[model samples]
Target: MKKTGEKTWQLRLYVAGQTAKSITALANLKKICETHLAGQYEIEVIDLVQNPKLAAGDQILAIPTLVRRLPSPIKKIIGDLSNETRVLVGLDLRQG
Candidate 1:
């Protein structure tokens, strides 16, 4: 259903608010997407505070969770997103 040239790869970052961990996750996700996916990625940030119901939708068990919702296979990463290698692997941006 995604249009051509629009990223089939979809991502969502779940955070509580403007906390340090949340900020770091956002920044790190941006950097990775820019570096690897470039213009072929769509990132949607969801604030659990605003939409607490969505938490159950993704079955989120913790804060600062990154969900890759598209590109055929889904993936997830937890924590502050400070670990680049782990994120890359989780998002399938890099090989193990």
Candidate 2:
């Protein structure tokens, strides 16, 4: 996660395909970023179905996994990301 005038977020959303969970995760991520990071974030959706080779680089063993590759430390979250609160917490953001 990032705050105003802070580092840009290099996020990678790893998904298998156009599955419902994948779509939901992407949508949820977009909403979260818009509400929080806004212009300070960049999401790179990687469809494993198209390029499975990329999975190894991120050690992605699960579908719908989000990887925050920017800032000081990198963080990863796996799932549909429907829980807005949990997602925020995982990204190290404030509850408010």
Candidate 3:
């Protein structure tokens, strides 16, 4: 359960399957969240391979897409998330 007043960073990662790109994206996401958002975040991984319909909701055009669903003004970053700086900037964690 979540506290009424606490804010949590909600992230959704869209991937097709357990491909190398998907695995890498997930790993990088974990590390980034731990280093930045810490315990104040939640990750919801959506495997399109399991449920292709879920992709439409997020308008996912590619695999390994990370969507920031919280903190308003939803944001998106597409790729394997190999670049920490790019991820951070895309997520609004740092200046572009």
The C-alpha RMSD of each candidate to the native structure, in angstroms, is 1.6, 3.6, 2.3
The better candidate by TM-score, 1 or 3, is 3
All candidates in order of TM-score, best leading: 3, 1, 2
lDDT of each: 0.89, 0.89, 0.92
Q: Per-residue CA lDDT of candidate 3, range 13-51, in tens?
A: 999989999999999999999999987998999999999
Candidate 1 lDDT tens digits, 1-91: 6778678779999999789999988999899889888778899999999989999998898889999998757788999989889999888
**Top candidate when judged by TM-score against the true structure:** 3
Candidate 2 lDDT, tens digit per residue, 1-96? 456665488889999989999999999999999999977888999999999999999899989999989864888889999999988887888553
Q: Provide the clashing-pair count of each candidate structure.
A: 0, 0, 0
lDDT of 2 at 55: 97
Q: Using Cα atoms with residue i matched to residue i, what is each candidate's TM-score against the true structure?
A: 0.92, 0.88, 0.92
Compared with the true structure, model 1 gives a TM-score of 0.92
Cα miss at 41, model 2 (Å)?
0.5
Query: Model 3: what TM-score?
Result: 0.92
Clashing pairs in 1: none
Clashing pairs in 3: none
